[model samples]
Target: MTNLGTSLWLQPPRNSPIWQQLATTIQGLKPIFSDSENFEPHITLTSNISVNTQGQVDFVLDRAVAAAKCVPQGFQIHLSSVKYGSRFFKKVYLQVEPTPELLSLARICREDFVYMPEAMSQARNYQAMSAEERQKIDTQVGQRAAEWTRNEYDPHVSLVYSDLYPVEDADRRTIETRLEDTFGSGYDESGLGWKNGRFALVRCEGPVDEWEVLGVRDF
Candidate 1:
């Protein structure tokens, strides 16, 4: 890795048989957002913050791995029915049921890698949340998240770009229904792989060198 300010993350490994199957299924679906063929499923841990040097990245990674090691291994999470976000409806998703461990891990990462105040200020909906509010939501689902869990964790990685707009309510519902009919009942539940956990810190543009390997971890 060449960049010092590379962001690190704990994500699912790529190249697993389960991921391959899921990707194939996603590619087969009519557009939901983007084909899963382009990527594998993974939960993002740390992001936005970056390591400035290769050595620094390595150190941070080692720390992250150690932090993750403290977490129990081989916990099973169920994949529930597929659901569509009415608000973010164009994108189809599989919601993950919140687990104590999952919530803890997410909280740890949030404390360490929260988006900077100025960074989020650019977004209209990105309001500055107090530490307390952040903590509360870290483990608890709000109204939208609660509704998502009604069936199970409908953890679908996006399948099309339908979330785009002006498709009438009926069309949106039709799209949502079609997605469930296509892959609603089934979900890929293979254990996460750590290899896909690897990512690079790159200049948001330019050459491949802009991409530098960072820390790797699994959800």
Candidate 2:
């Protein structure tokens, strides 16, 4: 847990056509960017779950099982757009539509796993502050763990991690264009814009290539 900690992910079924196309797209993009890493495509449900002990690992796995059971099996997630961002993990990804099912699953995952001590400490301090003082602090901080816990459930299936590349806005635009041309603009016309998939608990620490799946369950 010293690194970025663990995450729960919704991974496309490996045998599906959508998975094949996404894997191909990710591999094809690697040669175009310098020092890019290959990674399994997944939409993070909830992240930054610190698991520093065997007991915590077991707790996370058990929670993942309980969360998966709360949702539908073989759920479908549709793509909204091919986008890029400055964050290393979100350099290039397919933005997923914020469907009710997706949002519900994210909430469930967060309720189960994201118990950061920073959030707890901040909550106690905020309770002692006046309304005006709390608002001032919130304005200064912009977004904190509590805000993220409530509303920041952005789902994306990353296709490339090009943090080492000198990627410009134009490069991102070009990549987006090429991806849309290849994958059909996130509308499922090319049969690659959606996934019937399962959820997994992943050890997403250190290097992206080193991330490991601890468990996977249908829905």
Q: Which one wins on lDDT?
A: 2
TM-score for each prediction? 0.51, 0.71
lDDT of 2 by residue, 97-188 (tens): 77766776676566546643334356767678798976665554434433564567688888888665446777677777767766666553
lDDT per residue for candidate 1 within 150-219, as digits (tens), equals 3323233444324354445675566556544544433334422223243323222223224444445343
**Looking at model 2, which ten-residue stretch has the lowest summed lDDT?**
140-149
TM-score of 2: 0.71
* CA RMSD per model (angstroms): 9.9, 6.5
Error of 1 at 152 (Å): 19
Error of 2 at 180 (Å): 3.9
Regions more than 4 Å wrong, model 2 = 52-74, 116-150, 164-166, 169-174, 185-192
Q: How many clashes in each candidate?
A: 27, 0
lDDT of each: 0.43, 0.69
Cα error of candidate 1 at position 97, Å? 1.7
